[model samples]
Target: SAVISQKPSRDICQRGTSLTIQCQVDSQVTMMFWYRQQPGQSLTLIATANQGSEATYESGFVIDKFPISRPNLTFSTLTVSNMSPEDSSIYLCSVTGTGEWEQYFGPGTRLTVT
Candidate 1:
């Protein structure tokens, strides 16, 4: 089993700015994912952070916008660049297959871009 730790549980940023959230795991994990939860909406997969390699982003998300880095087994970071009002949402980091089909998620970094 692994535990997820996210920093700056919540924050409010200005438009045209950026915020980088960090994720730390208690144990070494192979699968680490970044997701976004829009206001009053479901979660959207952003990317898969590969250790020692660039993150693989999903459709509609690009590297320049959402840059991710997984330096080692138990650490990763995601940066949301050029923020906008529409970008106000909850950014979450999670690890899958911890138990059965269950995924362990961090408390999430709630970003409110003004």
Candidate 2:
């Protein structure tokens, strides 16, 4: 199992601003993914990070709005660009190890756009 941690466990930001959240894993993993969870909603996958390659985004998510970086196997970052009130949600980082089907998730970063 990999241990995951996220920076800025919670934050309050003004509308029109952006926030970059970082996710760190103790061990190298096969795949890293970013997800968004709104109040009273299930997790929505934002993107999948592949080391040394451009992140692959899910439906309704664009690279311009949610750019992701996977510099290495154990680290990644997700930036919420031009954030608005609608962007206020909990962002999570999850990873699956080599040959493992289970995904381990980080504590998550809570963002509130005013």
Candidate 3:
């Protein structure tokens, strides 16, 4: 089992600005991913941050818009670029530990784009 932590628990950003959210795991993990949750909505996968490789983004999401990086087994980051009102949501990160079937998620970075 592992614990997850995210930086800047919440923030308010202006349109056209960008925010980089950091995610860290207590133990090494093989799968790390980024997700977005709009108000009153369920989580939507943004990308899978593969270590030593480029992230695989989900449909409706572009690499240029939501860049992600997994530097190692326990650290990853997601950057929301050129923010807009529609981008206002809670960004969360999750990780699957070795031999684990369940994934644990971070507290989430609540972003409000104005």
What's the distance in Å from true for residue 111, model 1?
A: 0.2
TM-scores, each model vs. reference:
0.94, 0.96, 0.95
After TM-score superposition, the amount by which residue 47's alpha carbon in candidate 1 deviates from its true location, in angstroms, is 0.3
lDDT of each: 0.90, 0.93, 0.92
Higher-TM-score candidate of 1 and 2: 2
Give model 2's TM-score versus the native structure: 0.96
Which residue pairs in model 3 clash with each other? none
Error of 1 at 14 (Å): 0.8
Q: What's the C-alpha lDDT at position 105 in model 3?
A: 87
Worst 10 residues of 3 by lDDT: 95-104
At residue 72, candidate 2 shows an lDDT of 87
Question: How many clashing residue pairs are found in candidate 2?
Answer: 0
- Candidate 2: where are CA atoms >4 Å away? none
Q: What's the distance in Å from true for residue 26, model 2?
A: 0.2
